[model samples]
Target: MAEQTTEQTCPQCGLDMPVDAGYPVWCTGCEWNVAPELFVYGLGGTAARRRELAGRHSEGTFEELAREGTRGRRARLTASYVLSYALALMVHGLSFALLGAGVGLLVAGGGNPVAWAVGVPLVLLFLVLLPRFPRLGSRVPRLERADAPRLFGLIDEVAGEVGTRGVDVIVVDGRVNAGVHTYGLRQRVLHLGLGLWAVLTPQQKVALLGHELGHFAGGDTRHGSVVGSALYTLRLWVEVLRPERWNGRVARVLVALPLTPPHHAAQSVLSLLEKVSLRGFPRREYLADDLAAEVASTEGARDLMETLLHAARIDDELHRLAADLSGPHETLWAQLADRVAAVPPRERERLRRVSALEWHQQDATHPPTHLRVELLDRRGPSTPKVVLDRRTEKAVERELRPSARRLARTIAQER
Candidate 1:
């Protein structure tokens, strides 16, 4: 037989080369090697040329890469919460002080030094204490003995795989989703919803756990929490100082006669701050999903996405059945059973046979089913795509507008 030469091309560049030299055929033209998997998947032959062109054109900057690493909805929401609260407090304090002074002048005609003393001190105390008080000195409570060992071990194992410290784990007895939170330095805590534990498969569980870890790794937990706390307090002060017009006649009387407008405003501001903090809660979720992909495989991230979708479907059915029951206090378990029965017989059988171990909680602030599926579908080896459906985007906007308004009001009042 005559001797023959084998030729290969680089995936990054389009230069032809010898195949026998190595498994990863390098393109002499672009100086990039074709991934072995791409070759195995039958992109190795004539398709290799196409891949080379794709790789050459698909370049990204360091800044873009960094942004991808840290991108998370939760972190942004937390930041918004913090800012809104801080501004709310400032506005509420100023409003209260000015209003109190005005009222004191009108009532006592410059003879009420005591009113100024008390009012000023009260305002100062609120400014100094409100933002720091609620969130400070609070910790994620410990998990029970029965739950602690396995949960902690799993967290440690996942953290180890990602080259990071394991987060402190807690099991909250609620029908909600999981979250990772940081209070102070090295005080990371992972809270798992008992409902999630009931439904997720082992693989799905790990994926969800990994997702929470991603939040910590992305640096959203600790500093964001601190900022959120501060903002919450500030909002509280604003609410106390500037009660809303719709606060009803009784509330108006209370504010005008005893509490004063500033006090009412401060209370309103605080309530707004609390609500805004919740806004960050949702954005962190998207970031955690991205982190999950980075730490583990995209497959792992997909598992989490699927599990959440399933949980949501189950919860929605249960919620609808509960709404129909016409009782003040219907048992959730019974409602769930009724919901299960309402499904088609074939589907009901499948659900009935599902293990108790496969149920997740219902109250988590997870994005809807379609959105999660879309996100997972968009992920690949090279890069992950962010798919913000119109509904989620709209919800985000709706939540943010009120928060921004509160922050702006606080800023104006303070000035």
Candidate 2:
């Protein structure tokens, strides 16, 4: 195979490594890889056939279905955001407004202290009628840009490819998932699961990053925050006066009256709204998948989705590793790659086929891996040319090594 040339530079040590198409592209000095570069099996080769098969067993690729879903989601999201802020501001406004009226009435009453009676309702309204909203935070361990320049460098490049500003904070966590979190109006946080990263090929890793960054360009996280804040406020109001959590918690009898019929009604409405609000999420997920493919390649996207299909197996293996091995998180993690590699090619192929069997669940933000893969398969052929070395992988690993170890130990104790 002829070597593929890349305009890409090494994120760790900037160096140009250009080559002809067909082979993996490697750095001259550090040998850092540029993932998924060469052309390979792609939508151009398999889409029509796959779609034909999909139609026999699935709803088929209905463009109108996606369009309708997108339209519905936009309308709901706009209404939700407007209602959230409007209700929040209205409550605050009423609080101040009632306080103002109460003060005016008290002063007018003058020497007659009984005049304060006119302001009693207003005072009560000011203190008890308003809803309090909690500020959501990342709440995960953060990796600073200075400490992980190389990782951030690749991330920044991927963001550029996905047309995003990149996440403000990068957190390393235990879940085998990567996601973006935004607080209030802004403050985007990206969480990368160490377990997930440990298993991905260099090309698949790029696709994974692209998938996370794609959320920013897609504005899915922003939509989520609006719905989440609204639900949170309603939930808090509903729970505030519950009898069960009192005394041992905060004394429920004193607050029982505060949990009014109206609060209960709002809670019920929010519960229904929570399921209805994210209706378009599955479609947005497909769009993000598309963006990842666009930024990486069809092959990269396919590989990334394949990685998801193997998540259950990986998790089970990790659990077994924890139970069987008495070692730190890093040690368990170091063997993670080997465990994945040990999965026989025939079994992996069986998994790839099984991935297509996942059905879409109601209220799920993401469709099953099978459906996601089918959609991605439609994008034209693209593949990575080069892969990073173990040294480079270890360098990225060090960023979350401590956390991975801690989590591993925790898993062992839990077992």
Candidate 3:
């Protein structure tokens, strides 16, 4: 062998440099920038550049991307766990305090053991049952790959394209809706309602999957999942502590009685709390949609919006049919006639038209379809790079106010 020489060029300014000149063979000819680590990692050679281009050209390694995604997911879940514990502690303390105050009153009233026993159980109930109620121990269901291989492959391909992980895909057999969720450690799950699958064409399905991938890429699934879990726990606590199903007279009597007045008062306070918390759930849904849009393409967002609209129409029709079935009937035949009449001919025709449409539309817990479409159609990057405009910020702030208030109230009530 005479002499093996290597040729290298600066990727930035296209100036030639000799290889084996230590690291970062910066071209003296131009102000080109290259990280020395790239060379250290054996990614600086011509072959490496060609490989890089090839990797970029190809679909890329799904397994490598998924592994990275799993690492990110683990960090998010850890944070959620910490936050959940903190919130749980606050709720537990408040419940305990209320129970104590209620018991103290009963003690002053000739040391009533019956009242003590009743109060203790209520405390126990709040402690044991309240934290997990409403959204208790809900896990993202696992998707079987064998049943929907094509769908799973599509999901994996899309996820890889988006540089995210394919969440565990599940099929819910009904007319519900598709959703992506990140819940607990090592769990990112996507559920596609059978109704949605049945209705959507392959392209529409791809669009829906893209929209969901957007959710994962935008970190919406993790954020929303944690917030949703917290809300679930809080709602359950409120339900347990708050008075419900009690007659007005009974409630008044309970309120007036000094021995258990603290418990009644706590219950009253929680009723107000429940009313406030209910409003936040709707707002979070909107934020999640916005986040989803940021991750997916504008077309994906539009498709999602359309899907929601179609679902709403279908749901409305279903409700109408149900209403017709429940009407006052002269006989079985009359009931059948009523059911037939309940479905509006125009609505049925619309459903047929919607069904024939190229895209699949499914119901969502998001804003109205018109509003969503308007948002999606606006000319800009899917994810804004600049500071949000004042008007948009104000709208988001207004939407979040209720949740902020609930958080503040929870803090205050704990004190």
Candidate 4:
């Protein structure tokens, strides 16, 4: 139940605001008593300015897309898409050029010491600068079709509904998140976090799968090799250009001075590529949400979004559970579900408002959670095409228990 609100005077604006006993009280007119302690420290000079610029860009993008009203923008090759692709290609091209230069020098100047000196470093640098493919770490528990037919069948059903192929690998982990990505010649992999999965109802689970698989179906460019590889290469270049920490101020200056220009350049290019690539990202996300609604029903999709609001709390509980060595390992998931369910209605309201006020996002690439939810509300209700019944959920749960148990033991041991 919601706590009773009392009128309180805002210190900055003297405006009357309704104050909930344990929730933040703020003035709407002057925006007083907002999240004052949320600012990042040491982000003073250029860093501060860059963050502001990015914020402006995000605000503008959100407004523009929201105004456009979710028309048929899925997988449409806009000008921004074209430009982003070109930039990515250029980044890859540079790496190729560097490799060619080194090879040419070595081939032409056979026995020269200078050729060997320069060429070897150039070749080694090319190897270091290459774009990396994401792989499932050995520690993660992987589920196969034979091992979990019910789960795989559900995945395939959802995939069909979303108009995308099912994932080649399903890996369960301890995070409060789920994602799908391609690696190693377009092999699709899905990561299911038991922390989040444990708390979701069957319909919400369908919604979650729909949203992730929909990314592939909607042609999210960030998941594509061209832009994805470019982003990866740029990050590597930035890391390569950054100087390591040195003892003295003088030593630091000396080490940093020469690397500063190139480091800044790489960062600027990275920012540009990201800005361009992300122009249509919000639209793609909305499209995925649409797919989610189509497959799982609008109510289910909304419920899934609501559950995401409790993610931070879920993460905290997961950590605490992992740290409690004396606690029964088998009850970890049940304990998590119980704790999450126990969050008060007032707190849930607070979280919803906080998300709206903060423009809470899942990541840098995603639109604000509030915006996504609002868009869903605007679209109205949907009839589900697929459902996860109790029997199927039970079978799937049974298949997942061994993996979940192993993960729990690992977490406890590591802690």
Best by TM-score: 4
TM-score against native, each model: 0.46, 0.68, 0.42, 0.77
For candidate 4, the TM-score is: 0.77
Error of 3 at 406 (Å): 41
lDDT of 2 by residue, 20-70 (tens): 443344444653442222221222334345445542312432254333432
Report the lDDT tens digits of candidate 3 across residue range 292-337: 4444545555555555545654444433433443322212222322
Q: Rank the candidates by lDDT, best first.
A: 4, 2, 1, 3
What TM-score number comes out for model 1? 0.46
RMSD of 3: 23.4
Candidate 4 segments exceeding 4 Å error? 1-73, 109-120, 245-265, 319-328, 342-347, 411-415
Model 4: how far residue 82 lies from native, Å = 2.4
**How large an RMSD does model 2 have?**
13.3
Q: Provide C-alpha RMSD values for all models, in order.
A: 18.8, 13.3, 23.4, 6.3
Task: List ranges where model 2 is wrong by over 4 Å.
Answer: 1-140, 221-225, 246-258, 326-328, 358-363, 383-392
Among the numbered candidates, top lDDT falls to 4
How far off is residue 277 in model 3, in Å?
Answer: 8.6
Better of 2 and 4 by TM-score: 4
Q: Which stretches of candidate 3 lie over 4 Å from their true place?
A: 1-89, 92-126, 133-142, 145-150, 160-164, 169-171, 182-189, 216-226, 242-297, 315-365, 379-415
lDDT of 1 by residue, 276-393 (tens): 5444443454556656665555775765564554465565654454445443232443345344334333232222222111221223444333333335445554232222245543
